[model samples]
Target: MLENLGNRFQDIFKKVRGHGKLSEENIKEALKEVKMSLLEADVNYKVVKDFIKKIQEKAIGTEVLKGINPGQQFIKIVNDELVELLGGTNSRLTKGVKNPTVIMLAGLQGAGKTTFAAKLAARLRKEGETPYLVAADVYRPAAMKQLEVLAKQINIPAYIDEGNKDPIDISKKAFGQARANNYSYMIIDTAGRLHIDEHLMDELGDIKKAVRPQEILLVVDAMIGQDAVNLAKNFNDKLSIDGIVLTKFDGDTRGGAALSIKSVVGKPIKFVGVGEKIADLELFHPERLASRILGMGDVVSLVEKAQEVVDEKDIKSLEEKIKTQQFDLNDFLKQLQTIKKMGPLGSILKMIPGMNSDLGDLAPAEKEMKKTEAIIQSMTLQERKKPDILKASRKIRIAKGSGTDVSDINKLLKQFSQMKNMMKMLSSGKMPNLGGGMPMGIGRGKNKFF
Candidate 1:
């Protein structure tokens, strides 16, 4: 998820930050490194060119050359340009002035179109809109069933006509059903092909003609890299997409597509699919993304994910436990699970300030966490609540249950105990400088607690 690019940019920034002053040669070298990074990420060549050009123009001026903090100033300019390239600001979901705004989903097959449809419906539901899902993908019966399954899981109504093969007819009927039922939104999940073809295009065109949808969103795979840009362009050429929804962003994508699509097709990326779960779709925020690309992290997004999964009551209870030193292995396990519910470990780690820069790559960290979680899950409730109850025999049993050696469990328990001690110290006001020392346990550079 732009980890590679973020690392490269961070390294370059470090060199500039180390210098007491900025020179034209150093600035040129830094820009050159940035250009190469963007190109290596597969960002659209034109976009890269324009971006570097803008940064150069702003960076070489007197304001930057004579700035109090020249290195920070240069980074700021690049950040601003990155934000502009990503989309100047957040583009929100469009709701129709009239009832039941129709949002048509368009994309190639296996782009997670059906799943994204369900996610969108669920998101709108949270916003007080009664969204009715229309399974208009009549080409494949499985696609319709998938939508139905997702709809049922989310407790949303899915309008399906399995007997009908024509999507236009199904869509028209679905709209009528929505109107009759007083649904506030109609999300039509249309059919897609493995690749762009005239038959699929014509069918989608017909559906559009019949429904006159207010928003036509193209669901693209971020892992496709530059091809995503091409797909968005083709779709926008034919259907004029109002926005894009990038799926699988949490995958090990270079993030070229997300950066290139909007600039190439002139469409705002409305949402991003960060995980496989139905609750993973997030409304895209360009500024947060800009911060991530520059290795500044996205604390706002991290907090939002935490809020979504951790109820206020749970938070208060956890706080009380931390203050009283009652936070045990059970509470620790619950916190781990809560973080996992937010998303993958790597994605979550990048949201913490300075973590993304220091963790060379988080794939290894994620794998280690999974192993630790497995060991924790193998323990009994009593053992989890009170770690001291685990002696040699219990450790061996837990190790056998978790498919790990005793040492692995020992290390995890030790780390958990240390973390609990730290939390207790902080809560009891015994560690006033804990935040300054650790910085959320991510950043590098002589930060002992981190």
Candidate 2:
């Protein structure tokens, strides 16, 4: 998401670390580059200026210059500042003391507000919260229907009134229905307009008064960069939005909006839309994002994602197989499915430390994974458990089935053997150093075949 900005910082650090001892002049030169980088990222001019000033004030001080690993210390200073600029911490939704805490989502017409409502509902349901969807957007074409369809997909009940035209009445009725049905949470998707106006603001105000939403979330498109900041400001001016939901965070924006909105609009970003999938909305963590922007991947988040998709029973079984050195193609395919369920392969890889800018590596690694999965799936049950049974003759058959060649089959078999041996070492508390994400027998050096 912050690919451009990340590369710039990574480059600057490369230069910083290259020097044995950095002088004040050297640090100033680097911050100059940093200033240009932040400015080019479309960050608010004042935020950038203040951010750079804060870093420079600390970066050249005697405390850092004389510290061990001064260059790394300087980088840490910059990272810390970035975190502060990005909201410093997460802001969670406040649970109402009363039943059915209402959360009203407001955004521009095409900002994906309706879809995010369903996503939030799904998240709440996953967490044992009985969240109901209120399709109060009666103005847009098919907006309420879209919400109903999403609610159905997630098996959550939605409050929709085809006969009701006033959003205020629809919201009020929905709140009453939530109480009647014992819903703990209610996400009301308010109607959006092409642009802010008195009419739209008045409607939103009326609905807000009717429901007294616990969280008034302003959804903004991340692809618009600083323009999103301006939009957020206007919404906050009228409604004093409690937080922000930056949609299309996985898009090709320079990440300026995410870095600037809190400073401009004075509301923490509560969630970010990482992908189009309903499961893609993530609770915003500013520190994790700051680490990501500095090319230091978020391993904690990666583990959390894996935990979400990996079943405990399956994990125990997989552990047994790995410990016994009996992992088979079946186990491998199951692991691939586990990874897929977590998220996109590329996105998952980016969460690993030092892999944020490894898109070049991930593309081919993903391709190899898919090809390996295909070849393994084509094999018979016997061949999967005992690869030695796959003689030259069987290799040809598997190649034909998988639309691959015998040579491809041979390479996969060899890699699987190496991986098995590697697993044995890992199980015995021995780890082969995989310099730079080159997993055992997977990249360069020994087993670069894959």
Query: Which candidate's lDDT is highest?
Result: 2
lDDT of 2 by residue, 1-450 (tens): 888788888888877664545567778878989989888889999988899889887776535445456667877898898888989989999999988999999988999999999999999999999999999888899999999999999999999897899899899888999999989999999889999999989889988888899989999989998899999999999998999999999988888899898887889999999998889989999999998888889988998898898889998998999998889988988887787788877687678777677466456566777788889999999999999999988998899998888988888887677778778899999986655544434443322324
Q: Which predicted model would earn the best TM-score?
A: 2
lDDT for each residue of candidate 1 in 1-450, tens digit (9 for 90 to 100): 898898898888866664555566678889899999999999999999999888877766435445457668777888899999999999987788877899999999899999999999999999889999999888765888899999999999999778888899899989999889889999999988999999988989989999999999999999999999999999999998899999999898988998998889999999999888888899899999999988888999999989889999999998888878888777877877897788877677778777775555556556666677788899989898899989999999989988899998877777676677778677767864445334324335432221
- Model 1 regions lying over 4 Å from their true place: 18-23, 63-68, 357-386, 389-413, 432-450
Off by over 4 Å in 2: 18-23, 64-68, 361-363, 428-441, 444-450
- Superposed Cα deviation of residue 247, candidate 1 (Å): 1.8
Inter-residue clash pairs, candidate 2: none
Please report the TM-score between candidate 2 and the true structure.
Answer: 0.94
The 0-to-1 C-alpha lDDT of every candidate, in the order given, reads 0.85, 0.86
